[model samples]
Target: MSYDKEVGLRMNWPMIVYISLVHIVACYSIYNTITRPHYMLTYVWTIILWFISGFGITAGAHRLWSHRSYKARYPLRVLLMIFNSIANQGSVIHWVRDHRLHHLYSDTDKDPHDSQRGFFYSHVGWLLVRKPKRVLDAGRKISLNDLYKDNILLIQHRLCPWWNMLWCFIFPAIVGYYLWDESILNGILLPGVFRYCFVLHATWCVNSVVHQWGPKPYDNKSHTTENGIVAFIALGEGWHNYHHTFDWDYVTAEMGAIKQYNPTKVFIDIMYYLGLAYNLRRAYPKGWEHLKSRNIRKLGGEYHVVEGIYGIPPFCHRTVTYVQGEGGGGGRLLSETQVDNMSTTDEEGL
Candidate 1:
C-alpha cells in the first residue's frame, strides 16, 4: 500500500469508534452512579482517582517527563507512574514524544493535535488517525535518554497497561466483590469504569478547551492560552500560555495576578521539598515581568524600566536597575544593589 493511501486509511472512523468505546463505557458508569446511591464508597474512589489522574498528567506525564522541567527522585517518579497508568492515558513514551512534537511544531501540521486542524481534532480526533511514521519520526527527534536510563520510568512504561487494568478495574471489582458480591454496577461501573472516564475527559480538556479559549497572558500565537476556569478543572494546567513560553519553569504558580493557577505548582513544590524532586525552575524575573499585565487589575505594582549596567531597563517592577548598581528599596521591590546581587546569584545558579 502507498504511504498516502495508508495515511488516508489512518483516519478511520470505525477504528476510532472501536478504540474510544472504552472511554464511553467509563462515562456511562459515571452516569449510572446517580442511580446507585448505596455504594457511596465507589463515589469517593472515583473522585480520588480523578484527582490522582490530574497529578499524573500535569506533574508526572507533562511536566516532569515530557518537558523535563525538573528532576524527580525514584520514589516519587514510581508513585506518579502508577497513578499515570491508572489514569489509562497513553504510555509515557508515547505521551512525551507526541507532546514534544506538539511543542516543536505547535499549531502546524507537524503538531499532533494542532488546533488549526479544528476543535474535534484537537480534542481527540487526532488519535483516530494512525501516524506511526510521524510518531516514530518525532520520537527519534526527541531523544529521551534520561528517561530511558531512569529505571523507574522504564518499569512504569513496561507495566503501564497491566497496571492500568489492575488499579482501575480489577482492584475496584475486588472491593465490590467483598462488599456487594452481586452488583457489577456497584463495583465496576461506579468506581472502575466511571471514574476512569471522568478523569480522562477532564485531562482531555487541557488539549481542547485550553487551546480554544482563554486569555493570552503570554504567547497566544502558539495556540496555548491561560484560562482560570480551565485551570480549576485541570488542576492548574489551564495556564497554558505561561507553560508554552517558559516550558522549563517549574512554578506555574500564578499566571499574572488575577487567576490563581497553582495546583500543579503546589504538587511540584511538595515533591521538591520532600526531595522527591529537584532542580525546580522559575521563569526569569524579566521574562515573567513581560507577561504581567500593566493595569489597575494587576495588584502588583506596574513594571518600571530602570537603566542598568548595560543601560537596558529591567523588565519587572521588582527590578531596580542602576548604572553604578546603587539604590534603595525594600520587600518584594528590589534595590539596585539587591538587583545586582540577585543577578549575580542567578548567574551563579546557572
Candidate 2:
C-alpha cells in the first residue's frame, strides 16, 4: 500500500529517554512490591491513580474532547483536565489534534498511529520516533476551533509542565510521605512511575491490538476492530470498528447497556443524570442496520439487535441511497422505501 505522501522517521531523544527511565523505575518498583509488602497503602494509591488517569484519557481526551460526543459542564471539564495531566499522554490540545487526524486519515502515513506500519510502530514506537512531517501537516488541516475556545484545555496546555510535575509526581509523593508515612522516593517510583507506565500500555493496546486483531462486526474498510479484552482494560475504548463507523456516538460501541464492559459510557450516563453532560449523541438503530447490511464482512448468528441503549427509539421510516457512478459522474440514486420492514425482517430472522 502506497500513501499520497511519505514521512521520514526522526529520533525523539527526549521521549526515548523519558520512556526508558519510566520502564527502568517501574521494573525496580516490582522489587519493592515483592520485598515491601507492608506498603498496602501505596499499592491502593497506585490502583486508584491508575483508574483516574486511564479514565482521563478515555473519557476526557478521546470521547469528550477529541470527538465532542457530548457536552460537559465546567466542573466536569476541570476534573478531567486535572486527571489528564496525571495520565501524562500529552496536553489535551495536542492529544485531540493527533486523534482527530488519526480518525480522518487512518492507516495512512498521515495518521499519527498508522497501524499499517505494524504493531510496534502503532503501539508506542510512534511516540519514541519524531512525528512524521505528514502527520504535522495533516493535523494542521483539522479544525480545532472548538478545542482552542475551551478555557480548561487552554489552561492545561499552558501549564502542562507544572501540572504534570505537581499531579504526576509531587502530589503522589506528598501523599505517600505525609499520609501513608512512606518514603517519598518509594511513592514516586511505585504509584507515580509504575502506575503511569501501566495506564500508558493499556491505552496503547487499543491503538495496536484492537486494530490488528479482533472482530470487525461493523465496517472492515479500516483496520479498526472490536476487542473485549481491550474494552475491559481501556474502559470501553476497545470497540474500534464501531467507533470508527460512528465516531460521534458517545458510547463508542453499539451495546451501551450496563452489562457491556463500557465503563466510560456508564460514567457519561452518571454525568448526564447529574446534569454535567447533555446532548449525548448516539447512532440511530436504523442507520446501524443500514450500515450492517452493507458491511463487507457478514455478522454471524450470534449477533442480534437490541433496542439501542441510548434510549432513542428506532425510526419507523428511513431512506438508504445507493448511488451508481464512474469517475465522479452524477450518480443515479436508489432509495429503499421499506425501512421499518427491513428492520422487522432482520429482527424476526434473528
Q: Which candidate ranks first by lDDT, i.e. highest?
A: 2
Which digits, one per residue and each the tens of the lDDT, describe model 2 over residues 1-350? 57654445678899999889889988998887777753788889988888888879988999999999998999999999888998888799999898999998888888899999999999999998887777888888999899899998999899877777678877787888999698888888888888888888999998899889865545645688767778777888887888998999998887654544787888889999999989899885765876646421122233223222221222011123433443224644333222222443345423
lDDT of each: 0.66, 0.77
Relative to the true structure, candidate 1 reaches a TM of 0.74
Tens digit per residue, CA lDDT, model 1, 55-150: 888888888888878888878988888778777776877788888888887776667777776888788787787664654576578877767887
Query: What are the per-model C-alpha RMSD values against the true structure?
Result: 9.7, 9.2
Which 10-residue window in model 2 sums to the lowest lDDT? 310-319
- Give candidate 1 regions above 4 Å deviation: 1-9, 12-18, 132-136, 175-184, 253-259, 290-350
Candidate 2 structure lDDT: 0.77
Misplaced by over 4 Å in model 2 are: 3-8, 293-350
